[model samples]
Target chain A: MTAVSKLLRRSETAVLAILIVVMLVIGVINPAFWQADNLFNLLRANVVIGIMALSVLTVMISGGIDVSFPAFAVAAMYLTVIAMNAAGYQGVVLPFIGATLIGLLCGLANAFFIHTFRMIPLIVTLGSASVVRGLLLGLVGTSIINIDRMPPSLIAFGSSTVDIGGSKLSLMIFIYLGIAVLMWLFLTRTMAGRAVFAYGDDAESAKRVGFNTRRTVYLVYGLAGALAGFAGLLHSSMIWLANPRDFVGYELDVIAAVVLGGASIFGGRGSVFGTILGVFMLTLIKNSLIIMRIDNTWQGVVVGCVIVIATALTAWRDRKALV
Target chain B: MNKLTDFRRFVNRDNNIVQLLVITAIIFLLMSALEPHKFLRYYNFESISFIFPELGIVAIAMMLAMLTGGIDLSVIGIANLAGILAGVFFTRLYPAGPDAGAAAELMRVAAGVVLALGVGLLAGTLNGLLIAKVKITPILATLGTGQIFTGFCMVLTGGPAIVGFPAWWGFIGNGKILGVAVPLILFLVVAVLIAVMLTKTPFGLNLFLIGTNPRAAVFAGLRTERMVLYSYMLSGTLAALAGIVLSGRTNAAKSDYGTSYLLQAVLISVLGGTNPAGGKGTVLGVSIAVIALMLLASGFQMMRFSNHLIDFIWGGFLLLVMVINVLRNRGR
Candidate 1:
């Protein structure tokens, strides 16, 4: 492959490097870190965050950051759970659909302020983020409303695992893999995918070349919103409860993984595979801390260091790109 | 009506300061209406003025960084970290201390402040190196660093609050110079110094230029990296100062200490009309915004409002200002 093409592929390489290092380090520190049970648990716990990170990657690549992501997701989770409980609905699919729609609505609101009003994307999203979170808190009365009537199948959404020769993978892994493949196709194969990249790379230039800049920005944000919503549904289904407070705080971690995965905040770059690798690296590191019994306080320190180093490396790549 | 229109125009251009005064006046009026006996107490006014100085100090430092075309999301993090470190060093959290003798205590405080400033410098330099040298986007880099610093603080404290500072430094927090609180006086000195820096120093000039036009700043042969680095360092150090005061007042520090301040700082910064996308804003404007926010909080308290509701009100105001800015910019 040409050198230019090779440079374009480095995002995935960096994520892979991070994944390998942490995996080996964890394995060395505690042999059980690589054990099947623990790895599957790690995968299960990170399902919601990992999915959100993938969504953030899309918008960041398309030239905008979705600060409203966590808010949207949490809001969706809150609404779905509350609506289902209030309605006494029994169907799993209907509740999940309701959640997805809530997320989409939040995303569309962000896009409206961003595009139609010509507001700065960051400012608008930041505002909407707070508003959405407040709305959720107001709606949920700032309490954890547990879903006691959760069906057996619903409970299994987060718990069910398939055992393959005593080495099992959690259902979360499949969900992540499925979503990653779909996003990969969406970003690489279609006119919309090209638009996401072009808008992020240079929106004005994209507009000059006759691309629909406004629509592209809106769609990217909308897609980001929908995915965040979907993640909320998965989270509630997995955990058998919808929560708001913890999820918004987790957005920082998701953004960190995306950036560490080699997505440029400047937009027009990054991919799903890199992000998946980043999620795996973070999840492994966190779970390994639990296994090593090293106070788990060091989890933040380790993750922080990894982010700094990875970003530094990516910065190095960016310099080379500019040159 | 013509005169009023001109006056309104002036207020619009300088609305943050105007907004603060108007809100404070409105609050006092409301307080009197609710219960003239308690709300108009001299002590309450003293307390409000007393708390605002440190906030104003941090605001100026933050404004400097923002003026230089970057946001210092790490400010609150640094402040919380420094406060905890200061508390630990002062009270001897570990090593159980020689009880940190007065001289040692003083030394630790200074060192704590310096390290906080040093951390700021290092972070700012890293930010500069990336934006100037590595070509990473400032927003994402700062955002990452903000969390990392916050995570470091959380890790150090095990996600808990660290306590045990001598009440003596409450003197620092509650101290007054000729009837004005020490913090307020310090704030004034800081404000004047910042005003001079922005207008008098080449570094300041570089900041203004960079914010307005990076290409032009580069063309002017200004060391843009140095200017940006200096801005970040100042922001970090100022945030650390705020942390010190917070620790002094509360006699404790925690990991989650300044998470709330993240919104507070940004709210004031944005409310003061400092363009979030970069290049435009003033220290006076941010200071006014801080005062406005403080007043709003006090008003909420007077009205028997919960902290959560206060936050809701603050968020609502932020949204309103953003919408207005969008509409005005759209017209342009």
Candidate 2:
């Protein structure tokens, strides 16, 4: 690292370091924390959040907060499962595919508003988020859908684990890491991808420079919605049940992850590396808390504190950057 | 083509009104077509007018704060806290015969009003202090306070609702005065008082000017801070009063009583043509919009749809109205 970079360690680096230290402390206090089964379960638990955080990072970087992503995911998941079940197609792939496309469709609608209406992203997504969540609740009508038929492929997709030297690794971890790499490549290696970064930096300046900043904004939000959908698919497959109330506060966690990763909510500037580190940082804190056998209720308090501290620091940095 | 262009501008100029009318029409048609007898009743229409006043009062409070280029998310929380205080005192103030007939019960209600208003004013002043002195962004700072204050309410009530408030206080909520609910009449009085302050007084003028551009207002020698501070304090007091009304209407206090009002009140203000970025909008417009929303919702419920359906439609309608507004605004 450069000398200057050393003094001001990037948020991702700081987050990851904290995660590792916390992990080590947990392992020391309770060996069960580092145990193969428990760690795998923990990773499994964060799969949806980790994937959704990637989506949030994209939208936030593009100067919009797509709060509807989670609700859209719920819509996708419910519609897919209910439709396929009614069709007597007991296969999970059909539902997964259905949900993903529906997510993209919702994203497209969001994009249209962002580009056409110029409605503030927060307002648009939040409004639609409620609508979508409402529809999801309407569809299920207080009933849980249990997927027990012909879904070996889907279950295997989420259930598969790699045994690495007596330590088990979840398919979720691989899925999360895979998306991180794809995001990294898309962000760093492609023209449209880099344009996403530019638009996020400043829409006014970016528009002046002849970038189709408006269109790019739509695509970024669309992609975020799609990712949230994909994550929802993974969520349902792993749980083997579709409940409307599942992931009620999913958007909050995703935003928290992105902010903790050092992304600005006012838009422009984020790193895939930072987000990945954020995912692990929260995962670590949660897993460690469990390992310590502390009251689960304290989890909210701890997470809340970390989130405030992280966002405050990021905002402080943004203010400093302006200077 | 000429007709089409005119139609678009009409929709654009009065987007919120158009949305409200459209929603009302939809509900009317649905009721007539799907559930006629219940929907066409005049009682339901009257109910909408009555229920609307409480929301109207809150909207006025929200508009005053928004007019000063800030927000008061804590108002709903303050309302909830006030409601709980009212509930606690009602239960404890009288072990009377068949009602809270204890003269002490009246004192308790009075005490509840004052305490609630004090709590709300303190919260709003704290918000103003942070915004004026610490220079925190209004959105973020209010969001944080919203959480802290709401969290405190949840803690105070242990996340459950309070019920069994005094009967006399409940009567204040349910009683009619001169052919209108007493609370509704009270709301009208509050609205008129505020309308006078917002349009006729220096405080109101300063508020509008400050919202348009605080720096310019400051340069122009207005005490921008005082205007903002006063606006928030007024917002808090009004919200607290509304809380008392809401509790009396419901005959109980719940932690979640005003939780949903946060979004709904803001939506009404914005829908009433109040700019979120502030400077433009009137109490008259907002009051009308609030009445329209209540009518629309009650009209639908009267037509036999569930509350969930209304909520779904409400969220969608708000989105549609807000999007149209944004499309019209030439953002700088």
State the iRMSD of every prediction, in order shown.
2.4, 3.3
* Winning candidate number (DockQ): 1
lDDT of 2 at B273: 79
Please list all clashing residue pairs in model 2, or write none if there are none: A200-A268
lDDT score, candidate 2, position A138: 57
TM-score for each of the candidates: 0.90, 0.83
> What TM value does chain A in model 1 reach?
0.92
Would candidate 2 be rated incorrect, acceptable, medium or high by CAPRI criteria?
Answer: acceptable
The residue pairs that clash in candidate 1, if any, are none
Worst 10 residues of 1 chain A by lDDT: A145-154
Instruction: State the lDDT at B264 in candidate 2.
Output: 76
Tell me the docking grade of candidate 1: acceptable
The 0-to-1 C-alpha lDDT of every candidate, in the order given, reads 0.74, 0.74
